[model samples]
Target chain A: MIEVQNISFAYKKRTPVLKDFSLSIAPGGIYGLLGRNGAGKSTLLYLIAGLLKPDDGKVLFNGVDTRLRKPSSVSDIFIVPEEFDLPSISLKKYLSLNSRFYPNFSEEDLHRHLDTFELTPDLNLGALSMGQKKKAFMCFALACNTPLLLLDEPTNGLDIPGKSRFRKFIVSSMNDERTILISTHQVRDIDRILDYIIITETNRVLFDQPVSKILSRLKFMTTDKQQLIEDALYSQPSVGGANIILPNTDDIDTELNLESLFEFALVNPQALIDAFTNNINA
Target chain B: MIDNRFRISRTFDLFRLYIIENRKFLLICAAAIVGILICVAISIASDVSYKRAYSMYRPDLDPAIPYLVPTYIIIGYIFAALGASFMFSELKSKQGRIRTLMVPANSSEKLISRMLVYVVLYTVFYVLAICIAEFFRDIYLMAKMTVAPVTPLYTIFGNEAAINFLTTDKYPILLPCILFVGVFAIQSFFVLGSTLWYKYSSVKTFALFFALFFFYTISVFMLGSSLSEGKTYNNLDHFMSNYFGYVFLCFEIIVCLFNWCMAWWRLRETDVITTKR
Candidate 1:
């Protein structure tokens, strides 16, 4: 579990990336942190991983301040940054050097994840292409078995098949004790696998709810009828029709459409918040 | 509860990992040192041969020994200083910083492991490289001066100048102790500067060091001139003659400790994405 308490951070001489932001993430679910570019999603992840200290307030992992970066706290958390470099060494050598730090590291789990990604254990990391390297790094990160995994842009640079396999790999690695927080702009790549959705902007969280809650409150559909578009809380044009989010007054269970929901959050954030909190009428 | 912050086992693991990651770079540095020293030896041999042919050769002395000592010292210091300054080069880039800081080791452990590699292990490697270079130098000289008198190979340990520099009368072991402390203090300054500026750390550290040294020298000169104006400082001479060495040695030790502490503090506060604190 992680808690972000009134944290503020900014890059040098730039506008504040996050101002008085607060968030709490409980264990066991895959959290999809969605935000547009420069919306402080990745900054939040880095702060949670203790790679960056907050300008004010604190981020705590299981009641311990993450910024302290104690060995005990760090061993339980693994972060795969959006851009990273693996040493020019064999996969086996790299694992041998790094896996010892994580007490729960499992070679068997590593092999399983690699298999899901259609990769083998015997890999010369330096010789692999960028996508292959990312797959390899992701597999290793999953195998670390840390309780908290922070992934920034996990699905970037992946082939279509690789993206599907990544979803499978993440699902297979999930357990009751582990929490995976993924920050990405590519919503379609991970939307199906996420248990919870959190959409944030420059200084505020627009929406935070479980997928089931989102589905139970708002209905997503594509229709050409202008009547439905007028009644919908949010609507956007699509290929054959318009994608719309309507109030689920009849308790109709519709699948959560992440892309439409993300756009809806950005366009009409107040209505989205009202639909969840005040129960919008049909 | 046991202190997990500074576990010896974890420190050893980190030390091993650093060596494994940097093995290629270390090999290249060792090769360069040996190659440069061999070239210097060959040049000395050529100069000796030229002198012999021109009938200006001194047969009693080995010209290479005098030059080799200073060459080894100067080159060794440069290599060590650069290595110390580059000790935190992994923190220069976002990716490197992430990998380094995310490792499950305390800040002290990380700093200590890197110091072992860039400071302690580098000294060991430099000594070995110099010895190997000396062996090759001796062989080349023997081959080049077959008809001329060939002095024995210079032994670093037994050399009179080295012995005198390392040991002194009155304070026999204090000389080498002070020398090591002084060297460590200088290296620590570079390491501290490395943490301050990650990119081009060595160049920045060198520039900053010289600038500070210049200002420090000026301040000392002005202060001394003003304080000693119209004052007969008779005890100053005696104090300088008797206790200056001890005072300077203590100062070096303090400086060394301070720089190391500051470097560790900076490293602990490092952020993966930010260049500025």
Candidate 2:
């Protein structure tokens, strides 16, 4: 579990990216953090992981302030950034040297995950292509068995098959005691895997709700009718009609459309927030 | 209730990582030293006539010892600077810095482990390389003894004359001891500078060092001229030997301690973006 309490952060001489921002994440389930460029998505992840210090306020991981970077807290959390350089050593050697720091690291799980990605421990990490390296890193990260896992743009370098495998690996590795937070602009890549969504704007959180709650208040549908199109909260023209978001007055179950939801949140933020809040409170 | 910040086992883990990660770089540095030493030996021993003539002339003069002393000092400092840069190479990029910071050790553990690698281990490896190079060079000289036999003593033991000169009270063991502390001070400055600048840190630190040295030199020169009480050069020289040596020793120790503490502070304050910037 993690709590980011009223945190404000700014890069040197730049306007603040996060201002008076606060959010709490409970244990278990995948969280999708969605934002446009410079929305401080990666910055927030770094703050939670204790790689960056907040200008004001603090981030607490399971009640321990992350900024202190205590070994117990740090060892229990892992972050896989969009881009990282692996040491120029074999994966076996890397695991030997680094895995000991995490008391719960499982070599068996590492091998299993590597097998899912069609990788082996004997491979030289530095020689792998970027996508392959990402796979190796993800496998190792999962194998660490950390309670908190933060991933930034994990699917950026992954191919279609790699992406499918990534989703599978994540699903198979999920447990009741762990929290995985993934921040990305590529909604389609991780949309189905996410249980909760947090959409951020430049300096505030636009929406934070579960998929169930979002689906309960809003309907994602396509319609060609003029009346329906006019009344919809957000709509985008599609092949046969217009894809739209409207109030779920019928209380019908429907699949969550992440791309449309993201667009709808950005366009009609207050409406989305009110719909979710009203329904949940009621 | 679980805290492992200053634990000895974790520090050992860090040092283990440092050694395993940097083994290749250390080997390459050692090879380079040996290669340079062999080249120097070959150049000295190529001409049979010169080797014979040089051997005949000086029983008291071992050519290698004179060269080795300065080489030892220069190479020692050079390796220290290189080691400092290598220690913080992770801060050079966004991804590297993240990986480094997320290594599950506290900043203090990371700092001390790297200091052990770059300072302590580097010094050890440097001395070993020098010893190995001297052994080969001595063997080569003994084989090439045509006229007068070139004494095959290791460079440290030089000839009797050089040994006497090095051990003399005027230039005693205390001087080298002070110089050793001075070397530590210089190294501390470099290691601290490495934490401050991420890109081209060595070059930038070197330039900064020389710029400060120039200013300090001018200030010291001016101060010395103004502060001198019209004493003769001999009297000043005696005063330096008697009292100034202790003062300089204290200065070196302070420099070492100050810069080392500053290095720790810089490392502690370093964040992902500050290092990248």
Candidate 3:
């Protein structure tokens, strides 16, 4: 549903942020976007959201130029940025303001989502705590019901319960007509709901695969005896032993470690790709 | 057509958003205006009238002044406050509020919608305050009737329909609203300057304004005309000289439009959230 073809962007005189970056994200699935501190994850998201126009190349939504920011293009795109500011208006008013923008915004859905987050619609948003405010926005974005939802570091302020609620809400709140892309350094928060993982590095996508497929091809483990697998691409020491990830030569049952995969993918870029070379389409 | 469904009718929606977003601020401004006018009205009743416009401000004025100074000042303050709030809130709520801008809505609709609300609300309160001020004039005249014997209606409004027309003029509301639009548009340049900086966009706003104004003034004295034209133009007469005020107002509109274009471009260029990294 979203396409980025060799797009490049920079901030004023700074170096190129996204250097010929390219990726294609389809609809009806939740995708986890992973990257390092300066991985241009947020920039990529903003470009797709039509919040920022790319300097070189193009970003298209359903073959429509995102740069134009026409209503047809933007109405279907919504970005829940990392740090969104709320007005000093009541929850009822906030919903009233946003509902008019998106035809799909369901007031009933709004009430339900707000209820799940324990956010009172009658109360002023300013009166809510930080976590509460974030939850309120989460609810609002869900109610916006746009076809594509882009979230950047959405799990930042959530406590234990809130994080779990976020997972539940994502899986249930949206429809099959929608495509959801979430970018963050805190991968584990959204690890469960992410059906696909797209690892970003060097201004381009390094890895893109479904979690089920990614799991079947690689194994993540922690060893205290410092034992290393023969095909291990990268490893790090643990409290008792070490954390290791290896290419799954056989159909061995192993759980996926998003953090381990991100780290291994970073340190052993060639090895990770080479291991999956023959298995790209899988 | 699908365009009809997704029409730029969002201006009305935005007005609703603007009001709720700034309800408290509106309340505070309204209270301050009414409170001062009421105090002046009381003083006028006590037989103390004709206070110089600048030396002291009474609750009301001699209903006979050429232009209603207090009314204009109060309305000016309202427009300035609304415009400032409109731009600041948009900046303040970037991730939150900026998201709204991306909707298939028209930029002019969003802007004019807030302005429409500002105009309507400002006029309502302005007229109410003046009527209250006129009411005070009637009370004083009634007391003076013991010796002078004057009627209330003729003195208070001068002419009922003219007062009615002035009270509801397209000009009174439009002009002050337009003036505030200029001030707001000019102020937004400061905001755009601030967003370009880091945390101190506020202090940077002032610093940048002075630095640029100084740069322009010096350059004018040395080279010539981007920020400094001359000491010749101060008020409307100087600024508009010979041509209709509408012509000059149109030029001001262009300047406001320039400020708006720069604002939108600056926002898109930075991709602000990227700075979080």
Candidate 4:
């Protein structure tokens, strides 16, 4: 549903953030964007939303240029940033103002979700805590029911329960017509709902693969022995034992460790790509 | 694929949002207006008498009708407060991201709504305050002159001079309203600048106004210079009052457009994740 073509951006001279970076998301997938600090993930998402004018290339939504006619092109598109504020009015007023701008807003869905968040229509948003504010905005975004939803660091201040509630909301709030892009450094918080993962480093997408494809292409393990398993593409140890990723062979059943896969993709990218490509044809 | 249902005009909701956001404060403004008008009416009725409202005799100089600048200042202050308080509400804090970016309207829509609140709603109330003051002042004047033969109603504000001020002469009622709206549109930018800068945001708000000065100074300066033959800034008054009035209406429209697009550019790319202050 979203197409970004050969886009490159820089905040300052000679300090390239995203160089020749591009990614396309089809309709209905929940994309997890993984990158370290200052990785330009937020910049990329804003480019798609037509919030930022790209230095080069174009972000196209259904064949229309986003930057040139952003309002016309992406009025149905919504972005929820990590740090967001609400108007000082009650939630009822806030929803009225926002929902009018979004023709697709579902008041029934809104009522249901607001109850799930335990937020009343009468509460003034200015007085709510950060987590409460986040929940309220998330509820609104879901109610907007737009075709494209871009959430940046959506789980930052969320409490433990808030995080679990967020996971539930993210999964339940989707349909076949919508695309959700969640960008975060807090990888563990949203691993379960991430059907596809995109890792950015060195101004390029080192890994762009599905969880199932990644699991089939490679294996994850924690072995007490520190033997040189040369067949393994990459290895990193945690507290108890060494966690290794290698080519999946035979009929061995092993779970995928996203964190390890992300690390392996960053350190040994070629091997990671080769394993995925090899399995794609197999 | 879902239908294309997002419309840019949706940002106009900010107009209603702006009023609702300050609905309590607006009622407070209306109260402030009502209170001040009552006090002025009482003071003029009790202390100065009707002879003073229409024709205040200086005994030495000609009679000068008091133009109630204090009332103007009070009315100006309330609307100025409304504009000042919310100018940067969406851009200054985390709420800026939540309200401006996530809504279906886009950045331009958000900005346009804010400008509408400042120029249209606030200025309308300003004129309302003046009308209320004049209406009650007329009643007080009429009541005080019940015993006298020379009713001040002949030359009062809404009397012959009031109707003739526009209908008989060149200036239409639309002239003043246009001027007020146009001047306030330019003044709204001062609030926008406050949003861009943090230290400026915490200042006294409505009590602190460059908006008033900007409005008054431009009008006076333009009028004054135009009257002078050699002045570079021609008085807009020189144009037919109706034509000048139309110019202001057009100017206000353009300003509203500019305000929205500028706000959109500022907000569309905002990193709400880092916008927390």
Best model number under lDDT: 1
Every candidate's fraction of true contacts kept comes to 0.68, 0.73, 0.45, 0.35
In candidate 4, what are the lDDT values of residues A1-282, reduced to their tens digit? 678888887777478787887888788878999987888888888778776666688888878876653444555678887776565787887876657656678988887777776677677888999999888888988898888888999999889888887888888887889888999988888988888899988578888888777777677887766563454678787776777886777546687777888888788788788877665335
Evaluation by lDDT, superior candidate among 2 and 3 = 2
The pairs that clash in candidate 2 are none
**Pairs of colliding residues, candidate 3:** A71-B104, A224-A241, B40-B58, B40-B59, B41-B59
Candidate 2: regions farther than 4 A off: A12-14, A225-227, A279-282, B41-63, B146-162, B215-228, B232-240, B275-277
- Order the candidate numbers by TM-score, best to worst: 1, 2, 3, 4
Candidate scoring better on TM-score of 2 and 4: 2
- Writing each residue's lDDT as its tens digit, candidate 3 over B27-70 gives 88777776766565545444433333312332133333323444
lDDT of 3 by residue, A232-259 (tens): 5667777756677876766787877788
Q: What value does the lDDT take at residue B218 in candidate 3?
A: 62
- What DockQ class does candidate 4 belong to? acceptable
TM-score of chain B of 2: 0.82
Q: What local lDDT does model 1 show for residue B78?
A: 81
What C-alpha lDDT, on a 0 to 100 scale, does residue B204 get in candidate 4?
43
Score each candidate by Cα lDDT. 0.83, 0.80, 0.67, 0.66
Q: DockQ numbers for every candidate? A: 0.54, 0.56, 0.30, 0.26
Error of 1 at A75 (Å): 1.2
